[model samples]
Structures are given as C-alpha cells and as structure tokens.
Target: MRQQERLGLILDRLAKHGTVSVLDLTTELSASPASIRRDLKALEDQQLLKRTHGGAVAAEVIYELPMRYRTGRHQEEKNRIAQAAARLVTDSVHSVGLGGGTTTTELARALGSVGRSLKVVTNALNIAGDLSVRSAIDLVVTGGSVRPESYELVGPIADRALAGIHLDLVFLGVDGIDATGGISTHDEVEAQTDHCLMQTATRVVVLADSSKVGNRAFTRIAPIEEVAMLITDSAAGAPDLERLRAAGVEVITV
Candidate 1:
C-alpha cells in the first residue's frame, strides 16, 4: 500500500480500539516491520498519532473512523460477515433496517445483487447511495444531519422516521461487541438512532468482525441478550463465543 493509505489504515485501527501494536499492523496490513515503523513515525510527525515503544495511539481521543479508512480493513472477514447477515433476510421478510458501518454497507450490496424485492431503511448516506439507483430495492433514507465520518444520519429526525416503521429484521453493525455489556457505536447520537431502529424491528442481528469482540465504545445500543443473532468471522475465539452463547445469543461464525 502507498504511504498515505497505510497511514489512514493505521489511524483507523487506533480510532477503533484506542491503540495499535506494531505486530498487529504488520499482520493486518501485510507490511514489513520496518515499513510499519516508518509509517508510525510519519503519523507521529504529523501529530495524527502518538508513537509508543511498540505501538501507537490516536493523536486525539477518537470515536468513529472515517469511511475511507475503514472500508479497506478486514476485507475478507467483512465480506463473509455480510454474506452471513444477508442470509437472515428471507421470503417471509419484506422490509429490513440496515445500520451504518463498513460491514453493513457490504451487506447492502449483497442484498441488492440478490434481486429481492426488499425494502431497506438506512441512516447511512453511503448505503443509500449504493442502493438508491437500484430499482429492485425500496430505499428509505432517515432524515438527520450526517455524521461525516461514518456518513450516518443521527438525531431526533432520524429516530422519528424510524419510530413509525416496523421491519422484519434489522441488521446492526457495531464498533464493539461485549457479551455482557452489549453492542455500541462511537457516537452517542448514532447510538440513539441505532437503539431506535432496534425497537422498530422484530428481530435484530448484529454483524461484527472478530476484532471488536471484546471492545467497548462510547455509547450503548442494546444489551447482548436483546439481539437475535451474532454474525462474525472465524477469527473469533471459542471463549468469546461461549460467553455470548451463555447469554443466549445465537452465534454464527463464517
């Protein structure tokens, strides 16, 4: 990857978990240790991150990562999670709510390609943009000011739009997935609207990569038990799955 793209990816990980180790980046980005170190140095020089002995921290306390940075991360894992999530939509279900996040955006494309006459309600402008031109899917955009980083509409207006409609299912993408504490996003406004969307759906399915398994973010969307199923990648450990299973959540790993 180019230097700028690598820096954005590096910052993306820092924004997600607040810190990132050199070893992790070497594995995640398929870059050499020397290259990772050089990138970290550049980011620190730019004051975008704080360099540590073996890792880095975001320059400022970060909530959500910009879409540009996050879309390229865990590409295969996100694709698998998206496919697993789309399977939940069936002939019995006509409408669905799609929460904003890189993973759910992939699920939107999967749904669209399947050519189902599905009604999809979304708060993310990116997801809307992807499906808006397609005639197969009925798309509804919740009205609210966009949170530019995630391109999600979050506010009373979005909540109001979702409050009046009930859907067959809602697929949520979260920043963190703690088996006991529940799911969460980086921003409180997004969390509020996510919770509202959850209430409007009969069943809620949460899509997350294994990286977020034990993490926590700023705002809570709902308890783990409230979700109908958890779709993730095989990188998830057995212990985490057991914990979620103990909480009565149906866990599906792809």
Candidate 2:
C-alpha cells in the first residue's frame, strides 16, 4: 500500500483498538516489521501517537483524529457529496457559511471550481487558507483559538464573531448525525461554535459521509428539526435516512 494509505490504516487501527503492536500491524498491513516501525515513528513525530517498545498507543486525544490524517478516508464519497452540495448554491446565495471538516474542505474546493462570486464565512483555518487565493470569494474568517485536532477555530471569540452575521446558506460538516441526537461533533466547544454558525444561517445543510450517518458523537450541535437538509453519500443506510426524513430533514443522497 502507499504511504498515505498505510498511515490511514495505522491510525484507524489505533482509533479503534487504542494501541497497535508493530508485529500485528506488519501482519495486518502485509508490510515488513521495519516498515511498520518507521510508520509508527512518523506518527509519533507528528504527535499522533506515543511509541512504546514494540507498539504505539493513542495520542492524548484520539476520539477525533487530526484533520491531516483524515483526508484519505472516504475521499471519493466526500468529493461526490461536495459536488452535490455545491449544486445547492444557487444564484440567490451570495453569502455562505462552511463548517470545518474533511468533507467541507472538499466543498470549499468545489465552490472555488465553480468560479462563482460569493462571500464565504468560516472558522476553519485550512478552508480559509484555501479560499483566500480565490478572487471570486470574499472570505471572512472568524477570530478564535484554533483546535489542532480539527483545524477549527472555536470558543467565545468564534461565537462572538458569528453573532451579528447572517448567511444565506450554511453547509456544516459533522462527525455524527443521528435521527434523534441530530448533528454532533467530538468537542463541546466546537459544537457550540458550530451551533452559533447554524443559528445565523437561514438554511443549514449538513455534509457528512456514510460512516457518520447513524453515529452520535460527544456533543450535539442541534436537533434534526433545526437543520434544513442533509447531503450524504448513497452508501448511508436506508433506515437512518428514513429516520432523518421522518424527523423532517430533507435527505439528499448523492
């Protein structure tokens, strides 16, 4: 496997099992012991995990993996979802809000590709950085403390920045979306900041992969009724989609 794919697999194993022995990784990944150790060393260098004598353990915060390591997972699905979400930005939408996540990052790229003039508001440092070079986009990045895990700016400062702003539409990237629990993320502070963004927008469209469809994270952003629509991949389970639709959320499977 390629290095990125191997890194993703190692991180995935650590996230699920909390620790991984080099021998086990070599066996599972079909890589040599030396290669596995090198991968472990690289992850440790990034502070993604702590290396032991013969294995690696989860980092200080592992519930939410760093954004850099998450880019490879469900990439194709995210791109397709992003394209479908971009289609929702009609001529009427001049100002848009984008929440931070791997999928929303793809949406940012999709929006830029369309070459439509828009005023974009966001707290994601990476997304802001990507859109800043686009002349067609008037980027407004909120001031707040950055969370390294998700590259999101959150807390009182972010909430304050979003207070008076109004958005025509907001596409939120969530870690989890459930029929009863609604939309949620791993961090409570991030959830609060995201909720603030949602409150400012007339329409809220959640962008999530199939894996997030039926999951519930640590904190809830809002109830299902609060969101206007959900744009997810077709791989999402029918039962969950039906439940979300029953809760009055417009479900669009790309």
Using TM-score as the measure, which candidate wins?
A: 2
Instruction: Output candidate 2 Cα RMSD.
Output: 2.5
- The runs of at least 3 residues in candidate 2 whose Cα sits more than 4 Å from the true structure, single-residue gaps closed, are 1-5, 16-32, 44-62
lDDT of 2 by residue, 1-254 (tens): 77767888899888889999998999998999999999999998888899999999999865567787788888899999999999999998899999999999999998987888999999999999999999999999998999998899999999999999999999999989999999999999999999999999999999999999999999999998899999999999999999999999999998
Q: If scored against the real structure, what TM-score would every candidate get?
A: 0.84, 0.89
Error of 1 at 29 (Å): 6.5
State model 1's lDDT.
0.88
Best by lDDT: 2
TM-score of 1: 0.84
Give each model's clash number.
0, 0
